[model samples]
Target: MLVTEKSPIVIVGCADDNYSMPLATTMSSVIANVSSQRQVVICIIADKITQANKNKILKSLKKPNVIIEWLIPDYAKLTNAIISRHITIASYYRILIPELLPEKYQKAIYLDSDVIVKANIEKLWDTEIADNYVLAVRDMDIDATYVSSSKGLQNYQQLGIAPDCKYFNGGVLVINVEKWRRDNLSQEIINYISNNQQYIRWHDQDAMNAVIAGKWSELDPRWNSQAVIHSYSSWKETSLTEEMYNNVINDSYIVHFSSSAKPWKLGCKHPNRMLFFQYIDLTAWAGWRITFIRKLWLKVKDMMKKKGISFSQA
Candidate 1:
């Protein structure tokens, strides 16, 4: 069965003046595609959002199934603070809004801005978490257990996490909002980061991993197939083809772009990255014949102005 309010899928991202318009466009397109026949809510967390940005986002979103909201203390202050440059504050903005999310929505699927959702997100929303605290997928590259013992992770032992619990990635999370609030998980995550600011590498993800290390349920890797070397190397070496994607349509829920080679960036070899275009014409995101032409014009102008190259070019 297709996912609906009974199984709402929520996507979260942070944006500001500094954020890439393409990334937000991509996210909005993905949200619009997945929520076509169901109730889907896409929340963009930012210190403040501008009217211009709102119009751009709405224009890019081609599907009426998606609902976009700017999670802020007050919409009036959105013009004051820039979000992308302030990662920590952006994080706080996301953390602050769970209380405001519908009481009916006890759980949500949170994805980072860098991902490309290739399939119906409803499948992921429909996943049975059973009695797990929260559901998450482990990082394909960095073994949290190993990385935790490496340099800068000396605090791992102090946090009381079992050594074998495996440090998981927080980029894609199935959050149990009520449980998180009831257990004070968000506060614990914030406080833990505040207390140990120096030892962490990733900002909110690391702190969240520590807070819910052993507590979370291990989700299927396909739900969050990281795009790092380890995961990519494995995929490239396998004999898997488009047949795999076709056959596992229902079983495979999300295609997580959790590595350096994002679809928006150069040299993204992951097969699923191409799937993003199917939901929305990636090149036509800005309402042009081809996205690349618009991109080329922007790049040349930027280059003439001495602006650095973008990841899409590099």
Candidate 2:
């Protein structure tokens, strides 16, 4: 059943100016794909984004059904919280959704800046979390289980999580805002992260997994098709099956460029990177192309490297 809501569909995201264009590109796809009849509400956690960039987002989003709200939250409290390198504090804002949004919004869909929507956002918004805390997709390379003490369960055990507890990828989430606030999950997550700094490898993701392990509902693999090495190249893993890959390449609703091989950069092998560019064309960044000389140079360099030629030798 296609989930329909009487209330405005709440879509949440966070990003700095560095990703403003991509965020706009993502929002463009979202508004374009969502049903015209549905009222859309967008809330963004801004991280020092410029007024010019903000105007670009407003101009680019031109959809009549969408309403935009911006929030600038102080992240000073999270200074002691575990944070991974290269990941910004904006990425951590999703955890505070319950407190961040109005009371009317008892739930919200959190999307990462690095993703593009290909299907209706209502389908995700209307999904029934049932008895779970959140709805999310499983990771292609990372196992759900903590497995064992000597293995991947170090943080899991410290958090008193079972050996077989499921760990979800935090990129996309169907958050139960009421449940989060009711249970005071935000503070609990922060407390967990602060206490287990050594064990928190993925930082916010780990804290979320530890705090809400076995409590989230797993959505279909196609909803958040992460483009990992195993996904693109058939590297063997129990979590990522051949059938899953087929669904991702042929029928995914949202394609996530979750790894370092972002679609915007060169040498990315995700099958759906071009799909990202398709959305990019709709934004102000339209006609934007990776430099021809740079593209050719990268290819030539790749060919030379394959032939074992050193930089000086080349």
Candidate 3:
């Protein structure tokens, strides 16, 4: 398909050394799926990525119409933000994109490193933001209310937000850079994270939902089919109807591995996990797969750590 847009479509992502492979895989999928007629500029907020990995990433996305620009992030500003075993300070870097990029870029699509693009991203870029700060899909697994999972905003009542406000997954965001800058949304989100650290479960995602609760536009769930949609029972738990669930699972534009069980890791049962590897074959990390021995070793180490037996002691 020929894209008629005059300006380049700006796509933003964040990653550190640990997430370099997934980041490259995500961008490769974008390049593979995007229109050849449109110019694509990918701005990655890199945090301590090794030069070797940078070269691999560049090589993976080496296309005539695609340009890769790396921006070094200031980690010191994220010192007080909460992080978990799988989550890192890099997850919060999406909040910095508006100020980090040049003023000429008024809009951008922010994708998580764990996602694999299946459709032309120009379609997503064409989505109208209008007066909204962002356009995102509703979170399939969680909501605004604090429930048994402890994943949603715990202080919604305290924050004067309604109990039933829609909560969006931050995995795929079509951001309005101008709206964010005018409202100083990034700083407000950072301040919310700092002040309400105890209430943060999903960290930056939670902060963003809290700060921009009613201002964001909702996209179709097919745009961001989260990991939860893979399970029939899990899909029933969310707001999606049976048809909607099936549609998203069967034909997702972007498959997001939102759970801890990632496609690269052992025991990831998501049906689309192999699809991620399919995109991987199109990148610099082609033919890469985690070996069985390595998986077993990792499993054993996890079991040993749980049993309080350190590797040194063993």
Question: lDDT (CA) for every model shown?
Answer: 0.58, 0.76, 0.84
User: Where is the poorest 10-residue window by lDDT in model 1?
Assistant: 77-86
Error of 2 at 82 (Å): 3.7
Tell me how far the alpha carbon of residue 264 in candidate 1 is from the true structure, in angstroms, after superposition. Answer: 3.1
Q: Tell me which of candidates 1 and 3 scores higher on TM-score.
A: 3
Tens-digit per-residue lDDT, 113-229, candidate 1: 656666677767777765555788666554343336452145778877656666666666777776776776656766776677766666666767777766788766666656552
Compared with the true structure, the alpha-carbon lDDT of candidate 2 equals 0.76
Model 2 regions lying over 4 Å from their true place: 1-4, 142-153, 229-236, 240-242, 292-314
**Superposition TM-score, candidate 3 onto the true structure:** 0.91
TM-score of 2: 0.86
lDDT, candidate 3, at 82: 90
Candidate with more favorable, higher lDDT: 1 or 2:
2
Shift in Å, residue 182, candidate 3: 1.4
Give the total clashing residue pairs for model 2: 0
Best by lDDT: 3
Put down candidate 3 lDDT per residue, 263-298, tens digits, no spaces: 877789998899889988888889878788767876
